[model samples]
Target: MRQTFHTSGPVLMGDQTNSQEFHLSLEQITQAPADCTLRYLDFHGTQAKLGVEYSGTAPFTRDGIKLSPAPEQAAPLQASWCVTLLSPSASLAQLQQLMRFFDGQQWTLVAADTLAQRPECTVIRFQIEGDLNFDRARLSCLRVADQLGADLVIQAAATQRVPALAGFDMDSTLIDAEVIDELAKITGIGDQVTAITQATMAGDMDFCESFKRRMALLKGFSEKRLAEIAQELPLKEGAYELLTALRALGCKTALLSGGFTYFAEFLRRERLPLDFTYANELKFAEGALTGEVVEPIIDGDRKRKLLTEIAEKLNISLERVVAMGDGANDIPMLNLGELGIAIHPKPKVRMQAPQAINLFGLDAALYLFGLNDRQIEKLG
Candidate 1:
C-alpha cells in the first residue's frame, strides 16, 4: 500500500523532492531504506537530512519529525536509550555529525533536545534506539565525542529518571583540592604526600597503605592547622549549585568520601545540604595527629558498602541511585549505583566508569537526568 503526503514546501525522498506533494509506500515510511535519504524539519524546527537504509525489523525516525506510517502500522519499539552530549564548544555542525554517526550505526535518532545552551557550554540529549551493544556503542560514541571536544553520557532511558539518592566523592569531585594533599602542603611534606595521593587515586597503590603512610607524615600536625585548611577547602565549580538543585528536588544526598571525616563533615555542616557524610577518622591526641587512622578505612569496598547501606536506610532502590566520584577508590560505589559518573577522573577510572564529565563542572550532571536549563533554574 502507498501513503500520500502534502507539504507547503519541499518533501524530500531519497535524491528526489516535490514542491507540493509526494507519495511513499508503507514499507518506505516504516522500514529503513538502503541508499535512500529523508529530509524533514526536526522538532527544534531545524532542517535535518538523514541517510536511511532498509533494516527489515528496525523502526527509524528522527524526533518524530519524519513522515511516518499510520499509527497502527508504526513499529512497537521506540527509543530505548538516552545519550547526552556536553561540551564547552558544542555547535550545530557537531550535532549533525552525531546524527550521522547514529544513522550509520542503524540507530534511530528518536528525538534531540538542547538541555542547556550558553557560550561557555552546551548540553544536548539524544533519544535513540536500535540493536545496541551498549558498551561498544558507548565507546564508539565517546570516540566521536572526543574528536568533537565533547563529553558523552549514554544510559538506558528506563533508568534515566531523577535519582532518589545521589552520592558524591569529596576530593577532586565535589571539592577543588584533595584534603590530604592540601594538608601535606601545610605540613611542608607536599611533594611526598602528593605522590602517594596521586598513585592511590590513579589505582597504582593500595589506598590503605597510602593513607597510613601519608598520615604518619602528618603525625604531630596540629589540629589548628587542619581546621584552618578545612575552613578554606575550595569547592569544585558548580558543586553548590548542583547540591542546591538536588535539595530542591528532595533527593537524599551524601558525601561518600575516602578522605577524612573532619573535612567531609565541615562541608555538610557549613556548605552543602548533605544528609550523610562517611569517611575515615583521624585519631587525635593532645590536639596533634597521632599518625593513626580509625579502624575500617573507607576504601573502595567500604565505599560500596556504605552506599548500599545508605540506600537501604532510606528505602531507596539501587536503580534510583546516582554515584559520582573521581578516584580509583570511588570505583566500587560508582559501579554500584544505577548511574555512575566519573568526574574529572584519572585515565584508568574514566575507562571503567559508566559515564564521565570532563569538560564542564559538576552542575553539568543535571543534564544526565534529562533535565533542561529551565528546569534547573526552576529547581533553584
Candidate 2:
C-alpha cells in the first residue's frame, strides 16, 4: 500500500550516515478518518508506533493520503487555555454553546480534564490546539458566569503553570475591605473618602493624589488606633486557604498594595505566609499621623516594577509570575504578570483583565492553576 509522510522540515532519521531519502506522494488530508495506529520498524530493530484518535489531520498516512498529526498546519508552538467553571450550577448547555463557538473559529480541543466535580462549582480544563483572543474569551466567560450564577477563570496553558512568586493587592483582594475606607469610616470622613476612593478605583483620579487627600483628612489620627484597626482587617474569603495552599506548594507570596504598610505587615505577620511586603509607609510623629506617606509612594507603577524585580530575584521569567488585584491602580502589575487576575474588580478592571473571579471566594483562583479540591486537600 502506498503511504505518505508529512515532515515539517529536513530531518536526519537514524544515524546521519545511514539516513536515506524516502519521499512519498502528498495527499490533502481534510478530516481525520478513524481510530488508527501507525506501526513501523525502527532502525534499532524495535517496534515504534503512533496513535491517532482525535479529529485532526494525521502527520503520516498509510493509505496514500496526505495527513497531519495536528489539527491544521504543523505548529511548532501551540497555546493552551484552561477554562474553569466556578459555579455549582454551571450550565452544560452554555458550555457546549461556547465550545461550538470555538469550533467555528477552527480552534481544536486536544484534551478535556475535569478539575472539580462539585455540583455547586465545576471546574474544567481544556487544552486547546492554537492561539485565541484571550480578552474575548474572558468576556465570554463573564457572560456565562452572569447567566449561570457562576464564576469563570480562563488561564493560558504554560510549561510552568504555577508561579514561583504571587503578588496580591491588599485591599478588597487579599482582604475583604479597603483599609483607607475603613479608616475613613472610623474618622467620620467616610463619605468624602469613599468618593475619592471610587474615583481613584474608576481611574478618574491619580491614586497618589487621592491617597494624599485622604491621608490629609486623617491628620492627627492616633497611631495606636491605626494599629488596632489594622489588626481587625477582615481577610477576604479563601485568602487564608489560597495562601496556605501556595505556601505548601513552595511558592513565595508578596503583599503588594497601595494601602498602608501597617496593614500589609499585619497580614504578612499574622494571617498569611508572605515573604515580601511593600506598601505606602504611614509617616508618624509623636504617635500621631503626619498626614503624609514616605517619599516615593508605592503607586501602580511601583507595583508593576516590584513584580518584575521579584521575578528577577527568583530567577523566573515574567510568565512564571501571577498577580492579583481589584482596582484601577492595579492594572499595571496585573498586565505585567503572565497570569493577571482581577478578583471582584471594578467595572474598568473587569473589562481589562484577561482573567477574573467574580462569584467564588479567593480560593477560586486556585482553579485557574488547574487545582481541584482533591489536590488542594492533599496539599493541606
Candidate 3:
C-alpha cells in the first residue's frame, strides 16, 4: 500500500507569496524507492525545465527543490520544548502515562533523560518537538502531573548553558521554616504573626505593612533568642547539595531575601557557601530587638533590583541567572531570572512564576539545567 503525506505552506518567490502543496508518498520521502519520481509545476504556472538526480539514497536537491527523509528534517513550524517532571515517589507507570499523554498531543518526544533516581525523589526531563503553545502545554502537563502526584515544568528548550548566578529566597526556600514566623514564636505571638505572614506570602497583604505589623508584635524580643533560632534553623532538604553543585559549576550564589540579615548571614557563614547575602537588617539595642528594621527594606521590588545589580556588577547576563523563591514578594526577582523557579511556592506565586518545583528538594532543580544524576554526582 502506498501511504501519502500532504504538506502545504506559503512559498515566497522574490516579492510574491504563493501557496505550495506537496503530496508525497511515504516510500518516496522515507525510503525513496529507486523508480520513484516527484514532479511539480513552477510557481509562475509556466513550463519550466527542472532536473532531479538521486545518488545512492542521498536526499535529492535542485535549484528550487529539496527533499529529504522526514526523520532527518525538522519541520519549520515545530520548536524544541523541555518538559521536566519530578516527584518524590514517581514510578515507571507514571512516566509511561506522561509519555502517552504527549503522544496523544502529537508532540514527538526526541529524548527522555532521567536526571535523578532515588527512592525519595525522581526527576525526568523530556525534550519534545511541537508547535509552541507554552501556556497550553504547561496547563496540560500540570493536569497530568497533578494526576500522577508530581510536579511538571515546561519551557522552550533553549541552548543548555549552566547559569552564572543563582539567587534564592531565605524563608521556605533555602530553609523549611519561615524566619518571621520563627521569630514570632520567640515573641509569644506565634499565632498572630503566623497569620499575617501567611497572608503576606499569599499576596493578600502588603509585604512592607505586614512586616511592620509583625515586627511590632516582636518588640523587645531578645537578640539572644534570635541567634539561637538561627543556629537551629533547618535547611531545606537538598539545599546544601544544590548549592554545592552550583559552586562546583562556578556559579555565583546569593541569598536575596525579605527576611532579616542576621539569619541570612548566619546561613552564609555557617551553613551554605553563598557569594552574597542581602536582607533587611534588624535594629538591636541592649541585647534586645527594637522591633524596627533598618532603612531600605528589601521587599519584593528590592529583591528584583538586588538580583539585577548583582548580575550587572558581576558582568553576568540576566539570561545566565536562576532565581528561586517561595513567596509572592519573590515573584519579581523570580521572573527576572532566565529560570524563575518557585520552590513549593504559595498558590499565587506558583501561578505567576514561569516554573515551579513542588515535588522534590531544591536539588531537583539541577535537572532543569539538563544535568543527569551522573553529572550531578560528579559535580559533588
TM-score of each: 0.80, 0.76, 0.77
Tell me model 2's lDDT, rounded to 2 decimals. Answer: 0.68
Q: Which residue runs does candidate 1 get wrong by more than 4 Å?
A: 1-78
| lDDT of each residue in 1-380, candidate 1, tens digit only | 00112211122345343111123232233343322222221232233332222223223333322342212111222478988777665443455567677778998777655665454565666778799888888778778877767788888887666799999999999899988888889879999999999999999999999998999999999998888888888899889998998989888999988899999999999988899999999899999999998889889989889989999999999999999999999989889978999988898998888888877788888878767676777787
Q: Each model's C-alpha lDDT?
A: 0.74, 0.68, 0.72
Over 1-380, each residue of candidate 3 has an lDDT whose tens digit, in order, gives 00112211122244332212233222223332222112221111122221122223323221234532212211121237877777665543454467678878888766544555443455566667887677677668767877877788987777244689999999999999998898888667899999999999999999998888888788898888887898899998789999999999999999999899999999999999899999998998899888886878889999999999999999999989999999999999988968988988898888888888876678878878777666777887
Candidate 1 has which clashing residue pairs, if any?
Answer: 32-53, 32-54, 33-53, 33-54, 34-53, 34-54, 63-110
Q: What value of lDDT does candidate 1 attain over all alpha carbons? A: 0.74
- How would you encode candidate 2's per-residue C-alpha lDDT over 9-52 as one tens digit per residue? 12234422111111222111122233222211011112211222
Q: Which candidate should be chosen as best, given TM-score against the real structure?
A: 1
Give the TM-score (vs. native) of candidate 3.
Answer: 0.77
Error of 1 at 9 (Å): 28
Give the better candidate number (1 or 2) by TM-score.
1
Instruction: Indicate the TM-score of model 2.
Output: 0.76
Worst 10 residues of 1 by lDDT: 1-10
